[model samples]
Target: MDSGKARATPSFSAVRTKRAFEAVTDQIRTQLANGLLRQGDRLPAERELAEQFGLSRNTVREGLRALEVAGLVELKKGATGGAFIRRGQAEVVVSSFSDLYRLGAIRAEHLTEGRLIVGTAVTRLACQRATLEDIDLLQENVDDSAGSDAQTALSVNLDFHRLLARATSNPVLIVLTDALIGVQRELLKIYEPASQIDVIASRRRLLTHLRSRDEVAAVSEMEQHLRLLQSHYLEEDFRYRRRVAAEAKAAGEAASDEA
Candidate 1:
């Protein structure tokens, strides 16, 4: 076998440390970093890995479980099943953001402000880099959003942001946009949406700027729209908190009267 291909084998040395599982994971991580192991490549059987690492099968299994949780590998069962290298996924980032929001570590202000920053940059870059097809797609998204129910409008509006990020041709921006939007979706569940007609109109203006390749106008339009959205969100969040407080007060009064 070619030396390059041979490197794909479970050629890890016997680990002499007490924390053998860490060593097992370290070796596998190194291989992945070196490109010796790639997506869809399966590791050797548990028995083989244990032998190579000079550790128990259980210890090797523990390392594999850790890899699975880290999103570095996927474990499968039955015939034709083993630990396989996984391609990078944006969902991991999305999930992490969602968790932070749920834990109250990420507030509405943080999400909305981040969106403004990212959305403006995405618009500027997309205006410079977008193809004719990208513009058409964005127009189509806006058209679909119009005349839809509130729920459908919300979905399509979020999709527009995703499409704009995609137009930038920057994967990092796309991933960050997805993560921010994912968290915003969760935040939206707690508050009412702003005016859909206003959103649609702003989108039309944004598309016009994009079609003209006017980065300055496109970015300005996006920032203005996002600021309006931020104000609307903050106002709605205030109302939601007040509503909850009122309901709690009413419940307490009712309980005191009964007592």
Candidate 2:
């Protein structure tokens, strides 16, 4: 119990408990990432996972619920009932984003800031590690944005970001990119359709940055591009909302005075 340097580190019992839950999550995540657990792969029964992990069935259920919420697994009832892996989990990302947006836990500005930081980081990483094919994929994604609606362009633009993250050959980076891109998708829903010329111009600049393989320049360009977007779209949303609230308050006050 001494407060000095000789005291042993606190026992990791609590840490271990938390890690157990994470262990369960990681095991399933690993299977999915490695292709061992494909979409529609039926999870082992709760009893089976509990026995394997040396935990109670209730703990296993809790782990399953967490995965379900994370869009990794789905549970169904009836003759064919159990947890099934989802093949395409984009919906999970969308749902999670919608929840945050609805709760105001995530704001348009926050999404723009995340894109500025993470997008620039990914671009820099791509400059170092991108393969020729990766570059082509990114260019194609950029090209697709040229003619698409804002929502479609946003999706393809995120595809480019995710591709860049994958080109870094870092699984952690890819997952982080996906999380931020998911939020970005939500923020895009509020913007008007992007102009064809503007989309193409942005993509062309981005591709040029990638091809040059100048990490500093690529990162700098990405940050500037996102900053402009924040000013154009996200800041406008803030201004519009404030204006509406001010008008509503003025109308209510005038009505009360007339009464």
Candidate 3:
């Protein structure tokens, strides 16, 4: 290749084979994906897994850690606790969405818009299909959030939204809502110190709409709530713009003075 010039063609070939731990992890993950192992199902003990895979105990441990981090398995101590398939999949979705945001593959606006659309659907369904039990649980979540700090309040708020998703009785909706709200919760952490919006009143109104089974009112209320959320990130944008402008002005002044 010429110096400082790109190659005419780059070689394309398969990557290296999976490491021992990766192979072990892949086997277990495949079972989970295939539904051969249900949630809460315990895997063989670490020693047994090592023997089964013909890998060392350390390798088996590494694979188990990978599964735990991937939200596929839970490892507990004591005689009763081993590697159990994860019961809740919300974290898995949350982890993926968080990664996308961190990688700049998705933006705040994209997620916010997603929440608006998906959240409205969940709210409408909750209004139409929520049983009395669902209503009561949502009421509990809202009530719990009333006196909490910003972080706890954020969790409570998402719980209410998750309830709305569940009231829809659609698993796909549940996962989608979980991922969106999880990202929102994380972003809110950055602004939590300055966040002062009293969510209780807004949430109470939404609950009332749901309880009344007023689909239109429920959706309208959700849209309004989402607009309120937009203000938080919009304020962030304004602050960031102001900081950049100040820095640019400083740089320009310095350059002119030097000249």
Ranking of models by lDDT: 1, 3, 2
Best by TM-score: 1
Better of 1 and 2 by TM-score: 1
In candidate 1, stretches whose alpha carbon ends up further than 4 angstroms from where it belongs are 1-10, 15-23, 248-259
Global Cα lDDT for candidate 2: 0.73
Model 2 Cα lDDT, one tens digit per residue, 188-222: 66555345566567668877878878788778777
Clashing pairs in 2: none
Q: Please state every model's RMSD to the true fold in angstroms.
A: 3.0, 9.7, 12.0
**C-alpha lDDT of candidate 3 relative to the true structure:** 0.78
Model 1 deviation from the true structure expressed as Cα RMSD, one decimal place: 3.0
Q: Each prediction's Cα lDDT score?
A: 0.90, 0.73, 0.78
State the number of backbone clashes in model 1.
Answer: 0
- Per-residue lDDT of 73-143 in model 1, one digit per residue for the tens? 89999998999988778888888899999998988889999999999999989999999999999999999
In model 3, the number of clashes is 0
TM-score per prediction, in order, is 0.87, 0.65, 0.70
lDDT: which candidate is best?
A: 1
lDDT of 3 by residue, 49-144 (tens): 777787778988998999999888899999898888888677788889988877867666787789888988888877878999999998888878
